[model samples]
Target chain A: DTAVSQTPKYLVTQMGNDKSIKCEQNLGHDTMYWYKQDSKKFLKIMFSYNNKELIINETVPNRFSPKSPDKAHLNLHINSLELGDSAVYFCASSQGTGPLGYEQYFGPGTRLTVT
Target chain B: SQQGEEDPQALSIQEGENATMNCSYKTSINNLQWYRQNSGRGLVHLILIRSNEREKHSGRLRVTLDTSKKSSSLLITASRAADTASYFCARRNAGGTSYGKLTFGQGTILTVHP
Candidate 1:
């Protein structure tokens, strides 16, 4: 069984198309996050959700939105995608906020390709 | 966001040799974590060392943390081809505002010759 999973491991679409990626974690986590990894293998945080509330959004474009219906699922939806949007998007989850102990569980990133 | 840097961007060693990768961060952190990413795959959590703790070990892996230096290091003993992958260190800041968000380093690519 996968601890964290994402649908459509690879997505290819035209520059103007809209697309979405889904993520779920069976580990019973309380927090979920979205990160984008560029071509240079640089991963940066895009969004973070904790207990169904948006907590952190790091200067991500308005075209990209993240939704967390429940603690176990977080989805990313992009409107009017662009070539620059082509990157591997990763979903991660953690049991709770940490100072003593906590580590994240990551999904098998969705590789998005914008033509 | 960029937390800091990982030195020796690339590392190479023989199957039986040991491999070491170092990471440094800028601000204070509650804990430091190490992750491994194989080619075309997701990242896997390897180990974590808290700011208060100095060293931790799991099987063949050893992680050392130095809060004073704002640095951490991962050591793989008796490495194998299976250990060849990109290793990244992430910082988990302390406080409620962190929201469990991790700031990851650039990463170190390790290649173990079989």
Candidate 2:
């Protein structure tokens, strides 16, 4: 079974539209995170949630939001999608927070294309 | 706004050769981790070295950390064609409410030829 899985492996939309990507983990991790990989292959963290509670929120735009209804699920919702939003979004999960020797398991990634 | 930067953005090597990628970060860190990503896929965790530790080894992979210099290196020995991928270094910052948060480097693209 896949440890971390993301739905809608590919998404294409126009500007001013809203979209959501779903993520789930079977690792029973307590923490989940969302990361964006730009065309330049730079991976950056956008948000992090611990046990369904929002924790780390980077300097991402307010149009982007993350919701974790339960520990096993974390979803990203983007509003007013802009062309700059075209990139790969990755979802990851870990056992605990910080120095716990817990390695993060990543999903296959969702390629979002905004026109 | 990036904390880590990898050197030699790309590398090419023959089978059975060794490949080394270096990573440097600006802030103090609790640990440094290495990850590998194939084309159009998620990252795979390779190994992690704690700030207090100087070196670590796993199979054909070796990692060394220099806390004073805030740098780390990943050495892959006997690389094969299948080893071709992008390698990244991630750092866990020392001080922050975001303890588990990871800051990743630009990543080094490795091409191994048989």
Candidate 3:
């Protein structure tokens, strides 16, 4: 069974368009996260939600928003997609929000290409 | 800001040889973890060492931590071609407000040639 999964594995869109990526986890974890990997291969955390509550919000632009419908699902929506928005986005989940929660299971990642 | 920086950004080794990667972090951490990522894939957790622990081993992987120096090392013995991937070191911040947030390092790309 896949513990974590993401939909729309590859997305190619033009500038000024809007897109959304969905993530789901079956690991019975309470926390979910979104990370962005740029062309330079730099992985950075964008947002984190615990039990459907926003917990950590990084220095991301206002165009990006994350929504969690439940404890098991977190989705990312990007508006006015720019060329710089083209990057791989990974969704992760953990059991809790503590030190033991450090071990996160990541999905295969959704690659977004903006033209 | 990125908290960890991995040394030797890329490495190429022959099959059956051992590979080592180093990581250094800037702040206090509750624990440090190692993850491996195949091309165009998400990261997979390898191992984690707590602030109180010094060293640990799992299968052919060995991890050593130096809290004083704020650095760590990951060693893979008898690496196979399948071991070729990007290795990253991540840290769980010791701050109370930063729950479940992992700051990842710039990864080390390893290529094991068969």
Per-candidate Cα lDDT values, in order, are 0.91, 0.93, 0.94
lDDT of 2: 0.93
Q: For model 2, how does the per-residue alpha-carbon lDDT over A24-98 read when each residue is reduced to its tens digit?
A: 999989999999999999999999999999888999999999999999999999999999999999999999886
**Any runs in candidate 3 off by more than 4 Å, and if so which?**
none
Candidate 1 on A59-114: residue-level lDDT in tens? 99999999999999999999999999999999999888756658888899999999
Instruction: Show pairs that collide, candidate 2.
Output: none
- Candidate 1 Cα outliers beyond 4 Å, as residue runs: none
Best by DockQ: 3
Q: Is candidate 2 or candidate 3 better by DockQ?
A: 3
Model 2 ranges off by over 4 Å: none
List, in the given order, the native-contact fraction of each candidate. Answer: 0.74, 0.66, 0.79
How does chain A of every candidate compare to the true chain A by TM-score?
0.96, 0.97, 0.97
DockQ of candidate 2, scored on C-alphas against the true complex (2 decimals): 0.72
In model 1, residue pairs whose N, Cα or C atoms come closer than 3 Å (at least 3 residues apart or on different chains), thus clashing, are none
lDDT (tens digit, per residue) of candidate 1 on B1-114: 356999789999999999999999888888999999998888999998888899999999999999988889999999999999999999987766777788899999999999
Q: For residues B1-114, what per-residue lDDT tens digits would candidate 2 score against the true structure?
A: 466789889999999999999999999888889999999999999998899999999999999999999899999999999999999999888875764999899999999999
Candidate 2, chain A: TM-score against the reference: 0.97
